[model samples]
Structure formats: structure tokens, C-alpha cells
Target: MSPTATTPPVLTSVQIPCCVCGTMILPNAANQCPTCLAQEFNLTERLQRGPAGQKHIVIHQCRNCRRFARTPTRYEFAEHESPELLSICLKHIPALNQHDLQLVDASWIWTEPHCMRLKVRLTVRTELLSVVVQQRVMVELHVQFQMCPECNRDFTNRTWHALVQVRQVRNDSKKGLAALEMALAKNKTIRQHVLKVDTKKNGFDFYFLSNTHAQTFTNFLQRVAAMRIQRTTKMVSADNHSNTANMKTTFMAQMVPLCRDDLVLIHRKAAGSKLAGSLAIVTKVSSTIQFVGASPKRTHVSDSMMELSADQYYKTEKHYQMLQAGHRLVRFVVLDVELCDEQAPSGQLYEGPHSGVEKYALADVTVARESDFGVNDEMFACVTHLGHWIAAGDVVLGYDLVNSVGTDDWEMQEQLHGGFTLPDVVLVKKAPRNKETAAVGVDEQEGQKRMTKKRERRKRYKEGRKQKELEETAGRMGFFDDINEEQVDEEGEDVDADFEAELANDPELAAELLNLERDLAQLDDGDVVAEGEDNQLVEEDNQDS
Candidate 1:
């Protein structure tokens, strides 16, 4: 077959004249050359419609609090490049809200912070007549310095609308107040609403901007510890013309006097009731006080264990007298422990208010005062409930009933009537041991090595404290009602091995401490990287030297 003749296709171009420049160009939706369109068309003016009146915008910011007003009723704190600031800015531009417009890109324009001016560059695209139009729009932000309602109220004399006064009845030990403070620290909702925290001699004073916040804090305290709350309100101001009154509310929360390990002597009047007229030890303190019988005469079956609720305690507080406070416990060294037979009547397990988690065995323990270990050969022998935990050479905290003064009415009755004779020493809990003391039967070299390690750890701890102090000093911009960082640090330092052991033994306290630690970790997360960098730099300098 003969080869087919090759055919070529012809391409054609349609030319049009630009309206402004009078230049020949390809036909487009604008019907103009690129140069002419750039010179004649204004993207910003064309896009301005509806609520987008002009390129200039004004945003209100509080000069005192440094918070931006997102709306008339809402104020927010946002930094540069944050999504919150971007959202707040975008809401003011109504043209961007339209469905036909697409926001291709957005960026911040740098401006001096002192100038109080912000600028944003937005690249937008839209389609029209099968042709795409892209334009860059600049929006100017003018910061109007004005005090928000909250700031204004804060400047006034009556800043806070509610106040909370937390006081403990027996302030000898700060355990109750410390526990409450931990609860407050762990709860972000409570901390944010607290306008001010003032430490007093016996307790804390917390101020709130609103009554609702104060009420929420009061409820939290009730759930944390056993406390009685009394509420009162006073009229701060009255507006006769508007028929409105401003009232300030105050809540007083008094913590129960009883604490864990406390020895309580029940009064005679309440003796007729259940779990009364006898000496008891407080095993746990929460929204209620859990007591276990400490009387030697009471059999294991009749342990006389009971729970005293906050409300009931408050109603009959006078009926209870603290015989020995927890802080008064004396240290004792266990000389020996003779475990009694489980089948014996004296060794039978108590089925009363035991949690069943802790195993206890009946034993006759021989102990002597830790302070009097070498001073005198005085010894004490008693049957204890802590046989599972106590052993020879172990240290414990107990009440020296033999040496204690008989001041309370119950003790006087016991002395006069000869009804029952109390034990010479009643052990409560095992004392935590130090690294040096805990290490038993170590050679001289190992002991010296441990001592050197302990000294190094102490030095590092001191250096850390100094570093923390410097950081606090550098960032010490105090607000009107800011909490004292020093007090918080002191509280944290007070949590030694003894307190940690107590937390481990008590489930409720352990849970609260866990929450406190979690909150503290979150607060310090941002500083971790900076601290690491600082340590790395120090190490590098040391290596070079």
C-alpha cells in the first residue's frame, strides 16, 4: 500500500487589547494584560464588603492585666503566633467568612511591642468566570489600651466578692492544713479562681473574684478533709436607683481537731453510746475519723472500731478530748518481738473495722525509748497490734502512757476506779530509717563511702535550691493576690521520708499526693528543656576546663 500523506495541525492564538494599557494580550476574564490589571485593579478594595469596612482594625486590650478582649463579654490571654490570637483576629475580618473566598496563607507582620500595633498578611484566592484571582491583603491592628471590667474591679477597693477562711482547731501539727493545701494545688479549677492566698498563723485565707468560685473551693475542702463550714454574707454596696445590692460572702471552714495517730479519750456522757468511754487511736482521717480501740481489756472481737463523721464531730466536739497528740509521739526502739500463736485467744484476729489490706498479728513486744537506749536500762513490755510491721532492732513511734500526766477526766476516772490499767507504751507506726541507719552490718569502708555519697547528694540539693531561688528572683513580678512561691516550696520540702511512708500506708493520702505531684509535673514541663540545656552548658564548660 502507498504511504499515507503526513498531515500537520495548525495552532491559532486569539489576541485582545488591554482596556487600560492598550496592549495586545491573550483573551482572559479580565480582558486586560497582566501589567494593566496589576496597575488598574485593587484586590483589597474589591474584596471589602459586608462587615469588612476597611483594612484598619481596632482591638481592645487591658493595660493592667495584659489580656486581649475577644468580645465584649470575653477576655483572653494570647501570645504572638498562637492559634487563639489568630482566631480572635480572623473573627474581626468579615470578608474571610464568605464561602466563595479561600484563605491560602496567613502570617504575622513584625512590629515593635512598644508601638502597640500589629499587622497580619493574608493571601486569598477566589474563582470567577473560570479564572482564578489571587491577592495579598494587609490588615492593621491598633491596640486600644482600655481596662476590662475585671481589671477595673481589681483596682477598686472591693476587689473580691467572696472570701474563704480555713482554720484548724488544733494547730500544733500542720498536717490537716498541709493536706488541704495539696488538694487545692492539685485542682486547677480551684487554683485559677483563687484571686489571692494569704498564709496566717494557724491557717490560710483565700479570696475569690466570684461567690461561685468560693463555694466550689469550700465543697472541695469538705471532700478533702473533715471540716465544718459556716457561711455569712455582708452587703458591700447598694444601688437604690437600680434596685440592686452587692453582697460579699465569707466562708469559714474549721478542720476537725483529730488527726491520724492521735490518742483520743471518749467522755463519760457519750460512754453509753457505741464505741465510747474508752481510749482509741485514730487510724485514718478523711471526711470522717476512723478510730480503733487501744484499750488492753477489750478483746480482739470487741475492737470498738467506729467512724466519726464531720457533722457528728462538730455537734459533739466537747464530748471528745485529745489525750495524746500525734506530734507528741516518742520514738521507741524494738528490742524483741515474741509472736503469739494464731489459735490462742489473745492472738485471734479482729474482724471489726480492719481494711483487710494490712495483715496484723498479735505479739508481745519488748521496747525501750530510743533516747534512753544507752542512758538507762528501763524497758517496757506490751502486746501490740502492729506485730506484722514491728521487729527486733526496728524503731517505732508510740505514746509513753506511763510517763504521761493524767490530766483528762477519763484518765482520772481510770486512776480512781481501777477499772483498767493502760499499757506502758502503745506503739502507733514504724519510724522511717535513714540511709546510714538502714544499712545494717556494713564494713568501715562501705560506711565511709555511703557517708561520702550522702554529702555529695546534700551538696547537689543545696545547689538546686540556690538555682531555684535565682529563678524565682528573676521572675518575681507580683500580682495583687498572687500566692507565695516560698511557702509552696517549703511545703514541698517538708514531705520527707516519714511523710512519704505515711502516704504509702494511707490510700486516701497517697491518692491526694499523687494528684498533687501530677499537677506540679505539668506546671514544670516547660522548664525541663531549659534546665537540661543549662546543665549541658555547665558540663561542656567543665570538660573544657
Candidate 2:
């Protein structure tokens, strides 16, 4: 019976029903067919983000600086929405396991400035479905234009916790404004801390969001200018329930009146201090005024060690113009310099500010006005006016001296004792002779008028002056003699004058003629060796060879 039954029973493949749809399916197929599973499975069932409702993706942004609130930090307007927008969209969409959903694409379309349409394409994978599902979703977001807390406070204009009033004692608003701008540019943190800047006639007002920031700007000013500060506070608001009050603080900063290069006299109140009673020249203006006193005796006035005031203990005696503005520097050649131990004579002393106190030696230099002749021109200037030592061959600037007003002398003597005299000429900066003169022209017509007067004066002098004056003028114009044919002496015969004129026109031939004249003069002076002596030397040399 077993042998007869050995024929294998007919085995048939049975169709298995899908778990999800109860439809016949192959064994190798997933739990459900693609179509049936797609119909039954929900793509958003596992979405961690809840369905759209009262709770939505809310974005808080600043209206002024355009910063968005991004949980931990406020993102700048320049930041491109990346994981931020993705995380935000996922947070609002109805989803359970966010990992199961993949955002394929997301775009924003501005319906209005404050409103945007957010379109997102999501690829969703479900555990029960064989095929991936893609869903396109859209939402309209109305960006509320309500100001952020900082913006609201900024717009209120009264929200500043601290105010700084910078007052310049000299009422120099330009300098104050320039200094403020420079300070802000130099320090990034200080600029950032500043909330508002208001310009005034003699000072400036700075408003800061925080008291510490206001103090920071004040400290910056203190470090850069000599100033004093006073602080005050007032209660602006109070909360009865919380027992809290808002206090508005103000910082008043007073800047010094003394600026760089100003000469100041110390009063009796300042005499007892290290910087008191001595005359000083301001060299720098910063958190404190810096000065260099008379050399070898009093060198430096320290800011940290002394308290200096513009009005009470100090007096600004005089202000001198810089080398560029006061005088047009002329070309001057130093012909000679005489160094002596004796003090400079009264007639040769520097006359402008510090005169007899600072001693300088005598020097005789030749000065040539820019419109005059070459470096060989002769005009004398003693070294006392220069206030500095000079040596031969050094080209110095010839600055016209300012006349001292005698009426101001009595007042000046009170500040500085001893004889003080203004100079006839001041030797300013030393420079090369060939440099082009920088003519500061205020008006073309005014300059033309001055030139016309100068030409008229020169014409009168040329037509009316005596022979001695003519010789002096001729000597001064030595550089032009080689270039101008008419510059030859008119007293010469016609043939000589003609020859001289031709030579002047031909510079190379004129140079050769001058060389020949020099050789002839050497011969007349017996500078040329005798022919017999030359012959004897030549014979001796020939015998030695």
C-alpha cells in the first residue's frame, strides 16, 4: 500500500490574502498590495507635528534690524532659511516620527510684504505600505508686523536706560562731533552699544539701551580726551505689584578746552601740583592732554598723576598755526652756519611764542623767494628765527615772520617772564628746492589782483631803480642769464652784444666758450706748466722707460 501511494500527491500553490486588503497576493509580496495599501494607509499618521489648528508656526521678528527669533538666538536677515525653516515646518505639520518624513522641496511666495505662502513637498514612508507616498502641502502665513520688545522700546524713544551728555568746554562742536564719529568707527563694540546719537551746538547726546553701554562710551571718551564725568539717576517708572522701578541714569562728561599745539599758562592752583606753575605746549589730546615742557628742565606733563582743568588752573595763552597754513614756505639755501655758546642776540631771537627762554645760535643763510633766482641767490637770515640748528647746504623753508602786537606784550609777560621778541622770519620745514609750491588760492580774482600789484611794483623798480639796484637785481637773477639773450649787458658794443646773444641762444657753444675763457685765465695766472719744464719731464720719463 505504501508503494502504490508513492506517487507524489499533486501539490498546488495557494494564493495568500493580503493582511491589509484581504486580496489574493503572492507569498513574496509585502503585507499588503501597493494599491490597497496606498488606499488604506495614512501618510500623516506618524507625523510628530500636530495638525494645523490654533497652534501654528509663529515667527517673531524685529521690524527695524530685521532679525528673526530662532529659539536660542535671533537670526539676522542675511541668514538663509535652512534647517531652521525645515525644523519649523516639521514642528507644525501633523507627524509622529519626523524621521519617517523627508522634505523634498520647500519654497516661499510673498503674497504681501507681511504675508507669505509656504509650499512644501514631502516624501512620506509608511510601515504598512509597499510604495513611498509624496504629498504636496501649502499654508498661508501672515507675518505679524508687531515690533519686537527691543524695537518697541526703540520706537518709544524714551526706552533708553542711560544718557550721556558730552560737553566741550570750548564750545567746539565740530571737534566733538569728529571725535565721536572717530570713536564709534574705531571701536565696533562701542558703536554697537550706541542706540541713538543726537548732535547739539557745543556737545552731543548719546542714548544707550543699557546703562553699562552708556558707561562704555563714556569710558571711551575718557580714554581719548581729557574729560571729567558726573553721573546721576532718576526714577522714571515703578511697578507697585512687583515692587520694581525703572531708573534712568545720565552721565555728563566735560571735555577739556586745551587742544594740541596750544600754549597754556598754569595758575596758582596748579602750581603746587607736578604740572603747576610751568609753561607747557600741548602735544597730544586724548583721555588727557599731553604736553612737553621746556627741554632739560620740565619735559613731560603726566595725565595720570595730575588733574588739569581748562578754566580754573590753566589758561590758554596762544595758538600757533601749523607750518602749512600760516606761511607760504619759500626756498632757502643755507650758505653758512656759525655755532656759538653765547645766547642769540635780541635782534636774532625767535619772536613768535617762546622767545628768549629757549636759546639758539647764530646762522647766516641765503634765502631765495620762490619767484626769484637759483640756490645761489643771496638773502641773509640768522638761525634764531628758525628755533633750530642749521648747517650749510640744508634747504629750509623761509616763513615770513609775524609782527608782534605791542599791546599784548604786558599780558604775555605776566604769563611768561623774561624778554620775548617776535622774529623777522621763521625757518619752518626743510624741504627740497625742486618741489612745486602748493599755492593755496582762496579766489582767482584776488590772486590775480595780487599778481597785478606785484608786476606793477616790479615794473616800477626796473624802470626807476639805480645802477646799484640793477646790479643787485641782476645778481639775484643769475639763473636767467644763461637762458635769456636780452639779459646781456646793454653797454657792450653791437658786435659783442650780438655774439653774446648768439652764445646765449646756443647753450652748448656758450659752455665751450666759457671753458676756453677759463683756460685762458688759467694761462694768464701761470697755472699752465712751462713748455721747457714739460719737455724736461718728458725726457726724464723717456730715459726711465
Candidate 3:
């Protein structure tokens, strides 16, 4: 027996059954078969669900600026695929074993205001066989909206942290309020912080959501209004957790009673001080009150030494003294203007609150008010404040002092030389009055209507004639309305010359002119024969004579 072929028994490879499912599998396969492993690991069915049964997210969103509430001072605008949305969506996700389950991919499918959808791919591993399989799960997210604190406070009820009282002690509260409103319009930040504005008789009361905003507003007034600010706080609540006291703050901004162009009388005692007493006109008031002389050539300027308080300065009833007041304004025609030949006076001459007016060269002006109406009521005016604002032929408003007394010798001299007292009138503004229109009546209206109709007819006729003339001229110049009307060849006719060139170069035009000449000649022949017969009769009668 050929030494019995020592070949080993035929070795055969056989498929092995999976440990879990007992199904045939490759020898190198994992412990479980593919179908069994796939059946064991199902992410779609085992995906973590929300504690509320549905993937829902609750967030506070501002309806006004469209922001989500996260912190007391911070807000975010949520979008369709924002990380904030993803974080909020998965906040309640169930935990998974990292060794067996892993997230492969996740994405938002569709997002709307009320609802959203998400797709997640999870790789799940079978614990027994270590077989890896992938499963995709769809998640539905429901969004519920709640108004943010800001929106709630803005829309329904308001809780303010600060109150601001802006008071202008001036009698003209409307003007002050108008200026404040204008300031609000120019600054957007101030407008945003202003929660409410209530108009009071003296000024405005403002409510602010934050104390910082109120402080900012008060600081702004310090720059614009020469105001005094006072701050006070009241405890609103105590927090045991923070061991802090919550307080509501109030800001009061008291603006000076005086304004630009206001005339104030400083006490004689305070004159040498900042008040610059006598009759001081307010040139500018901001942080400090600026004063200048009331003279025509107001050349001197000074600042208040001390803060002007309401009690320190007395209010004057001479509202008409300031040109900006408008009520005391009187229209004057410049009759004459003459430069003073004398040397400019020194500040010592004017004495109290001279405002350096003595250094300015003065001019004597002769004027008559329009109200006098050529009644020979002439007044002398020394324009110190607005000297250059007037000239000959200028009908301007002049400050009148007919009802007052002179303060200085310069004013007395003006009264003596100008035939009246100091500032009998000073030019302020130019006002021109037009001829008054007559009242319309039924008969006059009818006549006016007829006249208007006639005028319109004439105008139409004139316009039509001009248009026709233009069209005729265009036609005569061989300028046709349309190029299609041009009958000439590609080489157009030479229009530089007139009749001679046409007859010589254009045979058709020459033929037409020849026919016209022949017709005229035939008609002239009969007329000539009749004239010759009449001439022969006349000659025979002349020979008999």
C-alpha cells in the first residue's frame, strides 16, 4: 500500500454559528451574525427621548427687538440652525454608554417658529459580538415662547429703577420742553432709555428702567442746560441671599431760570462779583452763565463768578428788552447813520458791567418807527449789540427804551444828541410787510374769473402760434418730421444755394418752374393788350386837346 499516502484527512472549512443568533457566519466574523447584530443595535428605537416625551424647548424671547433671554443683561437672536437651538434641544437628552453607542451625525431638518425637526445618526455596537451598526433617528422639537422680562416690562407693566425730574424754572416751559424734545430726537441712546415722559407745568418728569440711564441723562443736561443735579436713593427691598439692599434712585436736574438772550438785573452789591450787576444780558448759558452789555456794539463778554441762583438774582419784567422776545420789537427805517468822531469811551465811563463797550467805536443812527407812519416821530438809537445787522433801506426792529431811564452818562448823551434817551431804539430784526390783498366778493370774483378765462385763451393762442411758426420753419428748411418722408436719393440734394442752384442742377424743379412761368406769361399777355388799347384812347384824346 504505497506506504499509505501519509496525506492527512481532508481538512474542510465550515461556517460557524453566531453566539447570539446561532446563524451561520464566516469564521472570522464577530460573535454575532450581521442580521442578529443589526437587530440587537437599533438607534432609531433606542434613541434618547426628552423627559417630557417630546423634544421641547422653552425660551424667553423678546418680541420688540427679537432677542432670546439668557442673562439679565444679555440677549441672543435665535435662528434656524443656531448652536443655541441645538444646545437647548439636546439639554434633556438621555445618557448613553460611550463604548456601545456613539453619535455619528446630527442635523436640523426643518425649523419653524413653533416646531422644528432634527435628524441624528447613531452608531450602536452590539455588546456580545462587538458588531457595529448605524441607525438614524428623527426628532421633533416643539418650541414654546414666553415673553422676556424686557418685553414684559415694555409691553404690559413697567418697573422703573430711577426717576428723573428735569425742571426749568423759566416761565416759558413750552420752549424748554421743545429743546428737550429736540435733544431726545438727536440722541438715540437717550430715547431708548426713556421709559416714560410726563409733561409738567414747569418741566418734564422722566422714568427710566436703569439708574445708569438716569445718571447719563442728568450728565447730558449739565453740558446743555447749565443745570444743578441732585441725586437721592430710597431702599426698595433687601435680599437675604445677596446680603444686599435694593434701592431705587432719583435724579433731579434743576436748570437755571435764565436762558440765552435773557435780560437779568444783578444786585448792585453782587455787581463787582460774578453777577456783573446792572442790566446784564445773557449771551450764552451752559454750565456757566455768560453776560454781555446791552449796547449796540456789545463788544465785552464776561462769565459768572458764582453760580446764578433763583434767589440771588431778581427777575425783571422788561420782557420786551430782548430781541428774541419778539413782543417788544418795533420796526424802524434807517433815516441816517453817522460814525462818532469822538474817541471810543473807556469802560470807566459806562461804569457798572461795561462789557468793554467803551472800547468799541460807536455810531449814531437816526430812525423812525413804521408805526409812526411819516408822522415826524424820529428817534435816536445807539446799536451796541447788533450794530452791523442794520443798514440803509433796512426795515428792522429796534429795542425801545421810551418807558425807562438811562443807566450811564453815555446813555444820557445818546438821549441828548439823538433827541431821545439811551437806546430810544436799537435795530433787532428786519421785517417787510407786503401790500395787503383785497377781500374777494361775489361780483368781483365773477369778474376775476372772466378775466382769468380771457387771459388763458390769449395764452393758449400765443403758444399755438409759436408752435406753428416753429413747425413751418422746420418744414421750409427741408427738416421733415420723419426721415421716411425724405424723397431724395442716398446722395441728398445740395441745399447750400437757393433758386439758381435748383434750376441748374434739378431738372424736375426747373421744369415745374418753367410751367409756372408759362402760365403767368399767358395771363400777362391779355392784360398788356387791354392796357395798350386804353393807352391809345388816352393818346388820341391828348392829341385832340
Best by TM-score: 1
Assess each prediction's global lDDT (C-alpha) against the native: 0.69, 0.49, 0.51
Model 1, span 207-290: residue lDDT tens: 898888899989988888998999999998999999999999999998897778888777656633355655778888888888
**TM-score, predicted candidate 3 vs. hidden true structure:** 0.50
lDDT of 2 by residue, 316-369 (tens): 323311121211334455665543323444334334356543433334345544
TM-score of 2: 0.41
| Pairs of colliding residues, candidate 1 | none
What is the TM-score ranking, best to worst? 1, 3, 2
- Lowest lDDT 10-residue stretch of candidate 2: 295-304
TM-score for each of the candidates: 0.58, 0.41, 0.50
Quote the lDDT for 242 in model 1.
98
For model 1, what is the error of residue 360's alpha carbon versus the real structure, in angstroms, after optimal superposition? Answer: 4.1
